[model samples]
Target: MEPIQHKIYHVDSFHSRTFLDTYCAKKPEMDLGEECLRLTMEELHYFFKFANIKGGTLIDISIGPIIFHLYSACECFKEIILLRFNDHCIIELKKWLHDRTGAFDWTHALSFVAEKEGISELSEEKDMRLKAAIKHVVKCYDDRENITDPLVLPPADCVLVTNVLDVISKDKVDFIRNLQKFTKLLKPGGQFLLYGALNATYYIVGKDKFHLFNYNENFIRKAIEQEGFVINHCQVRPRKTESDLTDFKAIIFVSAYKN
Candidate 1:
């Protein structure tokens, strides 16, 4: 058998529209969205509201063109900066932010977040707030020592990363290196929230398979602790949707603070 690297495609070759339709669209059947989007949104909403993680700038580094998780975040932070790994993802994000025609409809996700907040009728308002909160959407280079090279960013009050490290990292050491790079974006005592899959080796998007760094909750906890982050809350939910598109055993949500 060949190495895992030879079997999986890089995330840079990902098709944004296909990825969104495959996992984020609201379909009648049980899909990856149930665990990846809805559960993540629910956890983020609860964490932002009760964890005392509010104010200042919030930086978001995520996989694909996902904005569902940011609905609740706009309420807590004054500004949001989105960092993307490639131009395709950046374009997809801008389409939604600018209300372009072919943008993915996020109404379902917005409605779910609104319902959670007890303002089911105010979903549109919530969407508008999220749009207003986003201050910048910039491309970042993972190969560079500074992901945002030539464009230094101020330390943010909060940093949120969702399903990104696992998809991009080549190995455990690469994962830790990327984690530290993201951590450097946070201010002292700043809050950090990470949402990812557990024991996931691969996920499919538009007939293409992308690699995921297989890891467990214990590894995640140890990594964050080693990076000087105090884990405040950590929860793992068993995989609810059984699909060949992804083979993740569980989903993990972690809330921590820079110590």
Candidate 2:
């Protein structure tokens, strides 16, 4: 088998329903939902902790069809833009956002976040807030011309990139370059939130596989700092999923500010 490379980022064959069912299923029977729950909790807690982030623009640079990452953006930002590399993820996002047919239901993830926030029946409320907050879902890519081009995009106060940098980058240098692209999307001193697997080289979506840059906590910190970001918070949780799902050893979260 040949090694997966950066080009896998352009493969727009994401199986939205299959991917969600395989990873986001509530496995109370085997307690397999712990990792998903933990990530949702940590993401929500961090978003709430920075209470000052209310009512601003947020840009979500996503690589997959998963909407769980955007759950907290609804509460923090007045306008949310879901940016992707191709039609696959954007199509799924729009389907959910527009209440169209065959949308991958994000009910379980929203409910999990609601339960963590001590709201038993407010998941629907959260769902509505997210739907309302998301004003646009766009297709975008990270290239020299794309990133270096003048910013025609509305200024964002916060930019969220989750599990995307490594997948799109070929190596550490590429990762840093891509990080610059993300930072450019932000205003001066804007907030930035990132989540990704630590020391991972590959991840799977259904039966198709993709590559990841082998990044460590130290590398992430240095890369962000190089782009003039002040780290506010960082956390890493040991991976708790079955090996077949992913080979990553831990999940890393970082909240920072452009400086």
Which pairs in model 2 have colliding backbones?
none
Q: After superposition, how far is residue 257 of candidate 2 from its true place, in Å?
A: 0.9
Worst 10 residues of 1 by lDDT: 1-10
Worst 10 residues of 2 by lDDT: 1-10
Give the per-residue Cα lDDT of candidate 2 at 238.
Answer: 85
> lDDT (0-100) at residue 20 of candidate 2?
58
Task: Report model 2's TM-score to 2 decimal places.
Answer: 0.88
Residue 7 C-alpha lDDT in model 2:
36
> After TM-score superposition, what is the CA distance of residue 56 in candidate 2 from its true location, in Å?
1.7
lDDT (Cα) of model 1 = 0.87
- Per-residue alpha-carbon lDDT of candidate 1 for residues 1-259, written as tens digits (9 for 90 to 100): 2357523333447887888888899887637777878888888888878887897899999988899999999999999999988678899999999999999999999889888989847546788899999999988877778889989999999999998888888788889999999999999999888988899889988767788988999999999999999998999999877799989999898989977
User: Cα lDDT for residue 197, model 1?
Assistant: 88
Local accuracy of candidate 2 as per-residue lDDT tens digits, 84-184: 77666677778888889887766777776776667857546788888898887777767754552443677799888877887788777778888887888
